[model samples]
Target: MGQREQVATSLAAAVGEEIGALLAPVDAELLRHYPGDPATRQPVHTVYVPGDTFTAGTVRSWGDQALAALDEHAPDAASLAAVLGLAGELAEPVYARVRAKLEREPVEDLRVDFEDGYGHRPDAEEDEAAARAARLIAEADRAGTAAPYTGIRMKCLEAPVRDRGIRTLDVFLSGLMEAGGLPGGLVLTLPKVTYAEQVTAMVRLLEAFEAAHGLAPGRLGFEIQIETGQAILAADGTATVARMIRAAGGRATGLHYGTFDYSACLGVSAAYQASDHPAADHAKAIMQVAAAGTGVRVSDGSTNVLPVGPAERVHEAWRLHYGLTRRALARAYYQGWDMHPGHLPTRYAAVFAFYREGYEQAAARLARYADRAGGDVLDEPATARALAGHLLRGLDCGALDPDEVATATEGLTRADLEGFAVPRPGV
Candidate 1:
């Protein structure tokens, strides 16, 4: 070979080796966990009730009660009409639609709380509660009235309550499995998580449970409630949300904000501990940043201001609930808590209105951007993804019909929309 040819060949070989090195298989332990798909069932809100009050039919009953209350309080349907931004003349139709939706599916997620909702009980009473909860779970499963997402919220694992909390969890899981098997979409909510160790310990317990019951590893996932100031920041002054998720050993599915508890931790007065408080906003923003690409869902806290009392007073409650829910939606927190049945109407209304109000403009922008037919505007991949996600979310929550979404997206199929939803490289 000529000298020039030999040098060129050697350089090409060297370049090939460099490229191969770059593409080499990553170390098993070093490879970061990527939460694939990100398209799981996302509930609009979780209805939390005390364990003693929980039953297979609890959520359905709540829906019925909510509908009856709406009819009785707003016989003229003015309250719903106002919340939905409809004219007085259109109130009846809109109220009917919301009423029908609640009747068909009253709750999307249900958390039978053994924490604050259940309060502290005697040991025998706690055991009974766990057993009752398990029977209810079986009943709900048999009756098919269980929400798509259902779980129990254990008492906090803080020093004072750790033993009772774990015992309750054990009893509940044991009774549940013996009755039948784990229910569909079962997730445990570990409330008031204040350290990474608590999460690791919880994961260890769950791992043990799976082994003892002959269940698949990772079958049980849990959500961490960032309810205290310590949960947001570790003792070292570093953000601890991601640490908590990692500690769960890939069993953490979500990080739920707790408005009142967090606010109280921050020394906010009871009256000021609200969904829209600046302190709550700061905490949620921290959670958003921490869980951005981790595949862990983020949920806002609930609005404690429920719609109750006389017909005239109920309107104000509806307004407050709707406003708070809309604020959470605007901040991109899709899931929250609903402590009362009356909050149901505004929950659906807010979600529907959010999507309906932006559908036309979002669709047009997405279409133009996809076709590269920009006019008096610029678009990027992030913008495109956001627009696509908005539509997908609307569809997921029953706010937007599949046919309408397809039409709006210029005939894009659900698969196409899913493809669009795939995060860009390094996102």
Candidate 2:
């Protein structure tokens, strides 16, 4: 295998083994982070809204409430400061955290996943579903208030059979973009994916939409959800996910681990506690493998269980998940979910960890490579090979940054290449 392929294979295998061992005792609740595509330069952040809660009337109500609250309280404020505070308070800590995230970092993209109609048929109650989606698109067009974040979610399909999902995706995304007036950078979130063929079907639909709309052929992008038992059970789950993305017109921009469905696939109970279990690792690893160097971001699933208790328990519980999430983010897994506002700290914590670890490790590894290269003009082939392997692994894991990677890899002679060709121990 080529270096990139080798690294991807090793990563997937290592993660699989690690998770297998970790989840042997528990039933597959171990949440694993998927490093996003190496080509993507932007930070990924997605905030989910319950689909059922954001119908036309409900969304209008939310906007109206903010306007009313501001009018009643601080009409003179440039923005809705008074309403911001009240809404901020009423808004879960998670929402406040999301807003804070906007202030603290450049969240390159945003995805709002409505809880209900996503990946399923629109209920009869959604008489104005198409109209509502069009309105959302138009609102997105205004773009004055909503952060330039991409609005995405699985929309209801009108088709009655198995093809309904993709058909729904086609109908909804077309309407959403045309009526909702999404920006050029919009991506569609495809939910409940079971195989590559399903994604391919959607890709065909997207292509047709693009042609009809006079847009670029690949403008219709996707963020896939790996939530099925068949997906998790595949021995080459990572490879399968990669194939699915490729088959889907190669327009996958992101991958999200579906915690609830994944948990159910593992036959675990439906309690909120199921999200963080080790079983989640398998699905996430598959997504990561698929994303390798493709610029497709991979996201870990959300924590379904909310910490509702004494301040101490909430703090401690959140602290643990925060640490876990930080590890994932630093390794290039940019986004995860926050079911409630309380998990905001974890999100910020992830951003801090990435920069801190990236800079520190880059400095250290570059220094070490410099010392070795400067001191030994006649370094033994075996030693050089081992060092090369070490650098390769380190760079892959974000233990070293771009400059360090360049320095460590510079001036590699043919003899050094000979040695490097020989697989190093534990590589």
Best by TM-score: 1
lDDT of 1 at 57: 74
What are the per-residue Cα lDDT tens digits for candidate 1 across 1-427? 6666443333667798887777665423223444433676688898898998887678889899888877776654676675446555445544665777788888888898999999999989999998898888877877887887777999888889999999999999998888889998687999989889999899999999999999999899999999999888888999998788778877888899999889989999998889898999989999988887667889998988778888767778888888888889998999898989998888887777777778767777888887888977687877777787888888777777788877887887777766777674334
| Worst ten in a row by lDDT for model 1 | 27-36
lDDT of each residue in 249-353, candidate 2, tens digit only: 557777788778778777887764344576776567767766654556788777655544664465455555566576566444667766554444345434443
Model 2, poorest ten-residue lDDT window? 28-37
Clash tally for model 1? 0
Give the number of the best model, judged by lDDT.
1
Off by over 4 Å in 2: 1-38, 55-109, 114-127, 137-141, 155-172, 175-181, 233-239, 270-276, 307-310, 363-427
* Number of colliding residue pairs in each model: 0, 19
User: Alpha carbon lDDT of residue 161, candidate 2?
Assistant: 44
Score each candidate by Cα lDDT. 0.82, 0.52
- How high is each candidate's TM-score? 0.90, 0.60
**What clash count does candidate 2 reach?**
19
- In model 1, the runs with Cα more than 4 Å from the true position are 1-31, 34-37, 75-79, 83-96, 369-376, 424-426
